[model samples]
Target: MMHLTSRYLISLASFIVLTSMAVAKTNPACLKHLGGGYGDAECYHGLSADITADNDKLYRNLRATIPLGNAHQKLLNDYMASQNDAIKYCELQRNAGAQWKAEHDGSMFPALYEQCVYNIRKTQSTFLQDLLKMANWK
Candidate 1:
């Protein structure tokens, strides 16, 4: 009886651990955008692609080494300063899309928009952190 109880406890513990990991791994925000069905995957994929392209462009612009006069340099500086905020704005839009999907019973456009927003936030956060570290901003 003692051995059986111990085995049962271990199995229960393992199940709990696995369940927690699955939940943690899932992007609930992304799933929320998925809405009631599975058909929205394509929309999510497209939005993610779009945001990724935007992030790529921003990275290229930031990494450009072209020399500029004070005025142009100031423009670059301003852009760098506001880039994170812009990314956050995109994230908000994405969240709004997710919310719309949830409210509307899983519309594809909203689901895709939410995914785009989440991707933008994730990409922007990572990129901005790297950029700031390289520039010794923080």
Candidate 2:
């Protein structure tokens, strides 16, 4: 009985490890280093930086359009120009990360925090891209 149980456990562990390795390869920048905090954090941070850079370019393109010639147009553009949406997203991610840490402890803190930050940055980038597209609709 003991031998059978040990073999079963070993098999389960191997299956889990193999599954995670497959997941990691699916997205090298974001998932490849997962299951370990430091490597995962590093990968996610780099992914976040890439997203942020893209967002900066999107913001610049959106800003350049600067819907002009009327008070309402200026108001709308100003709201988007101020980066309030991105700020709110970052704030939300920070709060969620803090809550996750409080509940889950530190072994996975880096992975969780970086992944959350990266996700929010990606969302922010998407929003900026959409806004730029909207601006170009004119």
Candidate 3:
């Protein structure tokens, strides 16, 4: 019984490692940015799985290739600033949409909120992509 259990445990561990490697290749950035729990496609509310996968690829590439040091720090800071701005902008838009929906007695579309977030992410990704090109990352 002991021998059988040890072999089973080893097989399980190997399977887990291989599965995660495959998943990482498909959505490498999701884990780096969102961490383990929220990294999967199910966490991306509005966008289709395909779109999220593409964004993950872009983010992963940017993260992997970005040069290190002060310039990289500055780039990260700029991204945070943009995120703050996006938050405010999205809040205003959401409020407005809420009021309009209320007036028209329409159902709330949760996807709208997700779409807003996705747009901000896309913009930030594009900026980073440009920066990466300028820095000549291979």
Candidate 4:
């Protein structure tokens, strides 16, 4: 009886570990949507690093590069407002992912959310670059 119980326990433990791994595996579709340039790791991890660096650059550029003037100030204010809206949209996407019911594992939700955020940030970065051009900044 003792030996049988030990074998059962080992099998149960192995099953749990395998199940956890299956659940935790990143969705390949989500990774591809996010550019899939991170090799073995998921795209969210790479995108997280990218978005952080981009946000830092955007912050610094907005703070120091744009000259102080009425036109520039107006542009900056509008950009900031758009940023706030983008943030809200990103949050909505994240919430949707969290509440998604179709996926059994739900591992793709986070990667999808991160992809959405990455796209938003990338768009914002492009807009900022355009603004820089308009301001005649090299």
Tens digit of per-residue lDDT, candidate 1, span 17-122: 9988654433335644555344465545554555555566655565564355546556655665575456445445545666633355544544455455556556
List the global CA lDDT of all models: 0.56, 0.67, 0.56, 0.62
* lDDT tens readout by residue for model 4, 1-138: 999999999999999999997656344355545433333235654554565466667756665765666576676777667775775565567567667454445455555656676677667778777766665654
Query: Pairs clashing in candidate 4?
Result: none
Top model number, lDDT: 2
Query: Who wins the TM-score comparison?
Result: 2
Clashes of each: 0, 0, 0, 0
What digit string (tens of lDDT, one per residue) describes model 2 on residues 61-134? 77678755656556655755555355444444544666733454556466666777777777777877787787
Q: Model 3, range 46-91, lDDT digits (tens) per residue?
A: 2334444565675566666655675775666676566647745654
Worst 10 residues of 1 by lDDT: 23-32
Task: For model 4, give the 10-residue run with minimal summed lDDT.
Answer: 32-41
Residue-level lDDT for 41 in candidate 4:
31
Off by over 4 Å in 1: 1-4, 11-103, 136-138
Show where candidate 4 strays beyond 4 Å. Answer: 1-42, 62-65, 69-71, 94-105
